[model samples]
Target: MPVAVGPYGQAQPGCFDRVKMGFMMGFAVGMAAGAMFGTFSCLRIGMRGRELMGGVGKTMMQSGGTFGTFMSIGMGIRC
Candidate 1:
């Protein structure tokens, strides 16, 4: 009778090794994906915050100009 060689060239992976390797791979992939998502989210939030701040700054400048104009008018009236 001929003996049959099992798969993996007669060197089967041990249960512990397989489990450990799987856990390591899963952790690595999860971390990579998490980092990518975190970066994307941070960039998106940063862009939005920058846009909001820019708008607020423009409004402040306009308001300041208007206030200066009013103050000038008031000074002229008092003169």
Candidate 2:
């Protein structure tokens, strides 16, 4: 069974259902993106077995600086 319409005659994604769907979609997209990028990096860098693994780790860790820097800037603007 499924809801045909909400009380307001709107579409029937209830609050919890909407939240769950958002999370599910986000997770799916994230997994697909991660796999695509990981494959690209592995191919693009062209490293040996151990070096390839290390390169991927190093590359992913590098994004933390960019994230932290932007976060601080946002906080600064609010303060």
The lDDT leader among the candidates is 2
- lDDT, each prediction: 0.51, 0.56
For all predicted structures, in order, the TM-scores are: 0.42, 0.42
- Best of the candidates, TM-score: 2
Q: Write the per-residue lDDT of candidate 1 for residues 1-79, one digit (tens) a residue.
A: 4444577558555545555555455545545555455446555666457765564455445444444455445444543
lDDT of 2 by residue, 9-37 (tens): 88766555555555455545544555556
With a 3 Å backbone cut-off (N, CA, C), the pairs that clash in candidate 2 are none
| lDDT, candidate 1, at 60 | 46
What is the TM-score (0 to 1) of candidate 2? Answer: 0.42
Candidate 1 residues lying further than 4 Å off, grouped into runs, are: 1-5, 47-79
Task: Show where candidate 2 strays beyond 4 Å.
Answer: 1-39
